[model samples]
Target chain A: MFVILVYDTAAERNPTVLMTCRRYLHRTQRSVFQGELTAAQYRELTSALSTAIDPEYDSIVTYTARSPGMIDSTTIGVHLGGPGDIL
Target chain B: MFVILVYDTAAERNPTVLMTCRRYLHRTQRSVFQGELTAAQYRELTSALSTAIDPEYDSIVTYTARSPGMIDSTTIGVHLGGPGDIL
Candidate 1:
């Protein structure tokens, strides 16, 4: 499946959250990550994030599609990084 | 179509971007927003955001699906506000 993960966490927990996500997805831009993941990997990613963040202030969301092509994404602005660069 | 928009912008421009998105979508978290939009509304949103952000440092991304169910979403931690609460 293709998943896009977006997160906003407390300043002190940002590093941990960022690092955990980078381990599984491409850092398309600050606070945004996306890539393909198997069911197990997807479960693992969310679990790691749940453990890294403070439930009171941090929020993380994942949007999944059956495949990358199923999602219509548009980016307006300079490219930072991510799977979007592939032609 | 159902659209999910996420943005990371320079501090000073955050308010403008946030307000613009709020007019068209539900604020799902600090940096994420999602709602259903007509093609005209989607175009207007991208245009508004493009004018509000500094391309060199800010990025705005939109993900669209045929229907809300086409994209499976999972949220961890507190949701600031959004359409997610509906039964």
Candidate 2:
């Protein structure tokens, strides 16, 4: 399975969380990681990484796909700005 | 593009935002929406939806996959529970 994590500036502070995440998942690029694992393994890896994260520094969004067909093809974004930002 | 909105109780309250989202995207199932749109269209839709959302009631996570190969294959989860929830 593949897991993608996108973090705002705050999330970058926790080195330990990033390190542990790197240990289990292959870092495909900066701030993005990927790997194929069974259900059990996926659970185990994410579970461990979550604890090491500091909630104050990070807001994480994880996306999991069992099959390529199930993937979402749109550009998903969260607007962290003011109400007027939406147009 | 496929966008999945998973709400942790609070996100369900904003009917207006949900309605707007439904109007633009095809609701594939409960809380999940799918459709194929150009980059400009996707941005416009999500931009509008973000404004009507109430921050206290919801935390939104959006995943956009342009191609099937970029999709993550792992089971992505967030443990909102206590620290020990990690195993």
Candidate 3:
């Protein structure tokens, strides 16, 4: 399945969170990440994130789309980042 | 369609971004928003966000799901917020 993961962590922990996500997904926005991942990879990604952030105040939400074709994205202003093929 | 909007803006502009999102979607995370909306409402959301943010730096990405039923979400850490019904 394809997943869109959005996170909000403390400024100091943000780098760790972003690095973990980049290992499995594309950094489509400063706080948003998306890409295809198998169920196992998704589990791994979540597991890594759980350790990288402080749940007490940090927030990470994952939205799953059954398939890549199911996702439709739009950019409102300047494109920050996205899949290489789409760019 | 159901929409998930994620934003990353300067601290000074964050409130404007969140407020605009709240007008049309349920904020499910510190920087992420999601909800079902008519096509027109979606248009309005993009317009308001466009006017409220600085494209040169602010990043806003919208993901569209054909239907609300199609969205599957997972929270790895403590939930910060979500739709009132789901809460």
Candidate 4:
């Protein structure tokens, strides 16, 4: 699935969340990441995030697409970074 | 619909896109916005964005949720801002 994960966490936890996400997706923005993942990879990513986050404090929104055409990605400004670049 | 819009455009167009989007949704981050919109409102928002964006150079991803229950929003850290904030 194609996943776009955006997160908001405590400043202290922010680095860990960012690190964890970068391992599985491309960091598109300070708190956003997106990339493709297999079902198993998705599960693994979520499981790892579970430990990195404090369920009560952080927010993560994951958009999943079964195919590349499932969601449209529109850009409006200069590309800060591409999906291939590791944070 | 509930929409999550993320954009990456040229630096010059970035401010315009951000300003345009802020008129419609809460600016959760530097390049991300999200909010609820009626069908007509969605159309209007898109129309405005169309003119604000250079299709060839900018990118925008809008995630629409028909209902609040349709998607899971998980939180992990201190809330920088809520959807209520205008910008």
Best by TM-score: 1
- The complex in candidate 1 yields a DockQ of 0.77
Q: In model 2 chain A, where is the ten-residue run with the lowest total lDDT?
A: A78-87
lDDT of each: 0.87, 0.49, 0.85, 0.72
Worst 10 residues of 2 chain B by lDDT: B78-87
| True lDDT of residue A79, candidate 4 | 50
Q: For candidate 1, what is the TM-score?
A: 0.91
Runs in model 3 deviating more than 4 A are: A85-87, B85-87
**Tens digits of per-residue lDDT for model 4 on B15-82?**
87788888888876556677888979878887888888887777666667675445445433434446
Best of the candidates, lDDT: 1
DockQ of each two-chain model: 0.77, 0.15, 0.72, 0.28
TM-score of chain B of each: 0.90, 0.57, 0.92, 0.85
- The candidate with the higher DockQ, 2 or 4, is 4
| Candidates 1 and 2 compared by lDDT, better number | 1
Which prediction has the highest DockQ against the true structure?
1
Cα lDDT tens digits for candidate 1, A1-87: 999999989999998998888788987768889999999999999999999999888899899998988888888887778665422
Instruction: Superpose all Cα atoms of candidate 2 onto the true structure and report the RMSD in Å to 1 decimal.
Output: 11.5
For every candidate, C-alpha RMSD to the true structure in Å: 3.0, 11.5, 2.7, 5.0
Better of 2 and 3 by TM-score: 3
Candidate 4 docking band: acceptable
